[model samples]
Target: MAGQNLTTSIIIPANNEAIWISACLEAVLASERLEQAEILVVANGCTDNTVDIAERYVKLAEAKKWSMRVFDLQIGDKLHALNVGDRHATGDVRIYLDADVQVSNRVLHQIERALDREEAGWASGKLRMAAASRVSRAYGRFWSRVPFMAKSVPGSGLFAVNKAGRERWGDFPNIISDDMYVRLLFKPRERYGVPGTYVWPIAEGWRNLIKVRRRQNKGVEQIAERYGHLLKNEDKGAFDRKQIASVALAYPIGFFVYATVSLIVRFTKDQSGEAWSRGR
Candidate 1:
């Protein structure tokens, strides 16, 4: 490590994530080669045992010579929680991970090492979508095959940036998609996908899946509407026509489910974006 690369901070913004925070921290505490790391769990508007569960990790963190703190806020805003976590973070590299995401042991270290550079670099681990339901699993199968998800660093559940990269933007704005906003700040070459993987669960049922998909589309539209310039850095690439045909041909059920979901999201009345949470 050189310069400020000496330290890494993992910031997790949690809202009523008691069901998932323990697993999230457990996976994080198992990171390797990250001797001096900080874990900031911002539990906002949590009515569950999220704060309590996070607090239990203090001893474990200290045993690893790492620091862990839980900040309980009265508001349930994800962006506000991220800003608060950033203000308290003390790392040259910052990893913003969702509370419901579970990283493999090597994920944090790999992403941290990838960002050790003089130039601004953004990075994230390989995404593995986990869905328990039949419909959601089918949709995830089709969605995961898309060019943006398979080829590009989607950074759906987690994204990390070095100190220089953080300067690309100020405090997170009230945006529908913070991940999209941040990823758009850098060009494709500036983004790196580590070899490690992280498990991100998909919204389970049709209603939940539709809600999440709608929010994602709304987030993209909101970004285009508000920060039109950042679109220049987007590298989603044209859809892979061959792959689409192959997937749809091989898995007609998944294709039908995915296509129907897209159609519903497209035709249904646009609702105001719901308050963001940990996919809850």
Candidate 2:
């Protein structure tokens, strides 16, 4: 597998993710098939010790025969961090990883195998939400069964692109929904959803859940307002009426909790100066 000639670049955009960045980088260092991978952790406007923690992994990265660098930026924008990381990266396969998300050792291999095909464009693994609170668990139960979440690689936390796939869109546009923007860039046929699981933790409390949901909804609205044409390819595995009904019937409590949170976020004014929820 080392002779396969695939060089992967993992770009993680972190903003005050000191709590989770260490574990996330440890998972990368533990990867089995990612011997030739280069990891770039872009710490953006972090007031905490994110950069320091990430720097601790440099020696481990070198020992593992992989390159890991930490880039500290003053701006807090995630898109800018991605662009900076991409500029410094020189891998044929680029992986966009969230600082709080963790993937299996086989995930890199899965992504590489999927992108090995000439027709493959972008790719990601299946998502599994990790939640402990009752509120978060209820929300996750219903949200996980949604058709799109169940079938497609939501790429909210983990996603990858090959060289040809990266060519489809240049630098990421200034958008809050960077994941959605990238997902909509290609048609469903152009992307591959590898069979593996990645961790996407739901925010802990009801209030935190609402905060995250509001931010997500706002991102979707921004994309629709600026890039409406891209919406044509957005429904890769969108839920059908029947599927939605079935989920509601099967998990009525969970659906009610999720819907209530959505309604509150939709009607409430967008909170300014809110801190980023790392789903801790």
Residue ranges of candidate 2 with Cα displaced over 4 Å: 1-4, 236-242, 271-279
Worst 10 residues of 1 by lDDT: 271-280
lDDT of 2 by residue, 152-174 (tens): 67888988988888888888888
Candidate models: Cα lDDT each: 0.90, 0.86
Residue 116 error, candidate 1, Å? 0.7
Q: Residue 270 deviation, candidate 1, in Å? A: 4.7
- What tens digits encode model 1's per-residue C-alpha lDDT throughout 85-190? 9999999999999999999999899988899998999999999999888998998888888878888999988999998999898899998899999999999899
lDDT agreement of model 1 with the native: 0.90
